[model samples]
Target: MQCGFAAGSPCEVTCTRVTLPDLCGHLFLDWNFSFAGLIVEEGASEWQLRYAFYGDGDAGWVHVLVAAPLAEKTFPSIVKFVHAADWHEREAEDLFGIHFEGHPRLGDFILHDDAWQEGVEPMRRKFDPREAMRHRKPDEDWRPHRIVQEPGAFVMPVGPKYSGVTESVHFLLETVGEDVIRSTPRLFYKWRAIEKLAEGKSADEVLLLAERFAATTAFAHGLAFCQAAETVCGANVPPRAMTLRVFLAELERLRQHAGAIQEICESTALAVANAHAGICEEELLRISGEITGHRYLFGLLTLGGLLCDLANDACAKALEKSQKVLSQLNALEKHLRVSSSFLDRLEEVGIVPERTAMVYGLLGPIARASGMVRDLRRAQPYLGYENIQFDVPFEEEGDGYARLRILFAEARQSVRIMEQAVGALQSGNVRERIELRAGAALGWVEAPRGGAFHWVRLDGNGKVARYRIIPPSFANWHGFHLSVEKFAFQDFPIMLSTFDLSVAENDR
Candidate 1:
């Protein structure tokens, strides 16, 4: 399949597949025939290609791919795709010294430029850590660009702290009176250098790190990372492990969706609806915690199989809880929808049209809200989701309200899936013990946000030679800019909080 945009646009830009004399190339190419933009970064033996297309508004979409040299023994390259996907690409350039040719603006997306010496780049392979430690002064020139500025425009900065405790991230809101004209999210407050730190770690050790990439999406990331490791190692997980993995993945989805819906209610100022959603979320989390020791369902996955077996009693208990929560959530959703105030605030607010969604390549609830039916779980069934039946919720409105409704519907479907999966659990060895060999693998899992992909290459000693992770947040980050366009300033907080994007996930 030709990987192209789905919004009736054709990509005509093609690069010359030639050998590079130097380690990197930096140049920006503009497409004459389409609204697409191409950023090409040349490595020692590969070229990283990023395809970017502008949407109807200020938003854009980007897809990344690496063209490797015909010869073997070349280092696998890293390419950042979306215009808003800055942190990942910046990390890639910093670590590998690969230049982003046509990047409109590229600097240290994660590490502040002011944090290093005048000419030193800390992420390069040859960069010394001792020197960085010797000269640790905040870079005075590290001032981020303010995106929106006009007459009567004022800034409303939110977070780095909030009324409710959550991850720390700063949002720079550009407002004209009550309407939000532009919004920029300042992330990297919780940079954990996950990929760079994983270098040379054993496959098993790296799997643990992958699981911790995101507390909420631990199982999904672990599954994707392990599957990639298994692919490279040529290890085969048993059917029972695969089945259990599927069940756990869906369970994670249910919990996350429930929490997101609750957050939506909170954003809408519906205290009663928010409280009910919160209760449902707690129930889902408790069920997951009971089944797997971790409340977020972490550590349930291994390279070749699950860490342990799924208990029938635990499955039954989780299913029963889900059944009860579903009934209550349904009733609450109905009431919230009927409330005029809630509907008035949400409906058509932060509207992202279908065309805009495609341009930004929005995923999960954000994409579904725009009428795009692209779910990796359904489109490419990696786990046992192929056998399980469920509907992918979609809406044409593409507004905050539509996103809320879609999340509600997905939560109900997730419960139905859990019910079916719990009944299907049978007595068997839930794990397959096998020795992993040396190679490379690719693993993908449909996280609550969207698709999470992991590419892992192992050395002869079964250690990770290279690892790359693409979380769903990397795809949906651009939607923030799209949603804030043409909305009132006060609506910025509600719009941003509605998406509930994880900066940790993106920065990692």
Candidate 2:
């Protein structure tokens, strides 16, 4: 698939060596027009690297998966693949210690909170993570990101720690007179070495580990982890389990979306709107607890099936609750649209251009808000989503208002999806463990934020030899940073509230 720059615009046909990474980007310049982003998975050894590229297409998502074994531990960096590969490549360097020979910025990223000592790569299987932490040493070469200082420019440090909704992230903003020149992100303060933790554990045990990585969408994470395990082992999930998984997952999405809207209102000082949306969020969580036995919907899924059959008429109850909450959400949205002050605060703030969002394949509501019609649930259906119908909403404006509108629209669709899934349920067995084979595969889902991807490598005994979890937060964090560039410093809180990111999820 080698293609070189014939003209400066697009490639003529297949060319030769892609060894020069710059050519990789220049070669796909046409693809970048529609290119979303890609997720990289290093195989059992350095023998192969599997990539799932959701690149250029009519919907801005040519969702396809392919694998290519590399000839060496080092492969040419694809910083040229898309404008956003810069961050993904750095992540590879931090986690697997892969050398991205020409990456502009390659150093400690997510694990920057003194989580590990210098020269320690926690995500690698051979390294003992505990030992890496015990041997922690300050990086001598680590220095504050250098940027050309404008007149009156000064470095402003926000936090690597917070006790509120935000996770542990240290933001170093270069600003002059309240105008941000650049925002440097220091993440992974809560990095628990998740991929390393999953190693050597059973698939069942891995579910528990994976769910904790992203607290808000625990069900989606659990489902993705189990799906990878099931796919590698050729296990079959029952019909009832499929429908139930969809139901619980939508419930998780509803709560997150509702909460996102509430925060957006709060960020604008719209206390009345926040109160109304906050009540809806609490109600959604209450009903989730009533059905799943956990507000986060944990402990309900297992490999091949579920922990147990869902409560009798659980579907009917969920539909009833969803309908009520949707009504409340509709009211809240109506109020928000007419609130001139609130709309003014959100409009044109934190604008993320369509090209930027598409380049990152920014997942979930964020990408949808940017007019990118790429929802994994629609593009690649899993867990009975094929039988359900709902609109994949998009907006031309990629601002805080657009994001807030997406939260409401997605919540409405989630209710519709759950209603259909509930009515389509049929009688079936729910639990049975399957004998797994030694292999590897990727599993993912339309998480609250975006797609939560889990790549699993099982050993001969069906034990996890390696695990990689890339949640939506990790993928979209860059998009958030990009949106805030040159924006006023005061807009930081508003932008952050609309992004509604889970730092715990990203830092992992």
Candidate 3:
């Protein structure tokens, strides 16, 4: 075992596979570091696992790396210490065929037993995408995992399929009566293997997939991906591009919050309020399309900077129109606040304690509502966020209402950010020439949902060697069960709406 980098400052430490779990335990309990993500990389004759952690202020990030030969497939599970690594380990085990020796739950995660055969290991380098067509063989004896042993206890399954354009995700709500005792979420029903497909692709090509993976937060993910590529290539974006990036990012954030608020209203059966919120979301989407040529802001990010420069007049006009939309949203929020029925559904529902949020490493609005204060834009400034003035809205209640308030507050802040960014826009080029070098770097952003991380390694040929994404959904989904359990089954949809998690991001 050898340390690859220094003691701090985005360091990486290499250790034996046997010692990995203990070392991670020290980092978690002793150091009080937050678990960020886990990535598995393929080597010529071995496989490497990289565990990412968020260190204290100025320490930035710390990564622990461990490798085992292909023949020695099993590795120790760190879930005994870092509870947040549960889903990451399960996903790795299912996709890479690298078993975790102590993982209590591994199989039937991303690949459902009813559709995909066991031992497919789609992420292995040797696996072919063409083989997917012939791999559909349902397991006749498969049953959903159950922990409730009482005779009256039963599982009420809610959706591997749902209506109205929602993606696939199954939740087993175990209850003996009206209250849910245990809630288990099963995601990644339509896993695209986007990271596996990114291998050998140019940085520009992979950027497309990153943004499209979660279309709702397209620009934020695209910006994170571009930053990773820019770091690997040693390219610096122009000042104008940085300001515009902030402008567009806030634009996306505002639109996303509006949509989330709409969903929350709909969940409470506030039809009139839902209609108002939906109108606000639609208006913002229109403004986004008018400014960026895409309602979702696709094709707007490139390796070095944005794909094209935005005119100051257009950006300013868009900001003004968006501000009007924010005003309407604020009015709707004010009305909903006074509506006792609406308040009853959200005020005390789906509570996630501050301690539970931190233990699970929750992100974005979910973390903020729980009083975690883990916004990456403020903690680690990027894209000129340090130069901009905006507040990170948070609430202490950690309830459904708290999350909803965070969305409303954040939407207002987004408008303020865009206003500042538009006024500070510089006159210069938006793109820069890149010299793609063989290196790995992490790019991150305080996306609307929360902090998103993108890790990229480029080969000497200027193609991506490995691309790993830790979207906010992937982080927050791990903790979704915390809010669902102990609550009545009637509160399920309301709680789910407040989380505003994206299934597409998780499936990627």
lDDT (CA) for every model shown? Answer: 0.68, 0.75, 0.88
What lDDT tens digits, residue by residue, belong to model 2 across residues 237-275? Answer: 988888888888888999999988888877778888989
Question: How far is 120's C-alpha from truth in model 3 (Å)?
Answer: 1.9
Q: Which stretches of candidate 3 lie over 4 Å from their true place?
A: 1-9, 139-141
lDDT order, best first, reads 3, 2, 1
Q: Write the per-residue lDDT of candidate 1 for residues 354-398, one digit (tens) a residue.
A: 876765656677888899786766765666787888999998988
Clashes of each: 11, 2, 2
Q: Which is superior by TM-score, 1 or 3?
A: 3
Cα TM-score per model: 0.83, 0.89, 0.96
Candidates sorted on TM-score, descending: 3, 2, 1
Q: Which ten residues in a row have the lowest lDDT in candidate 1?
A: 20-29
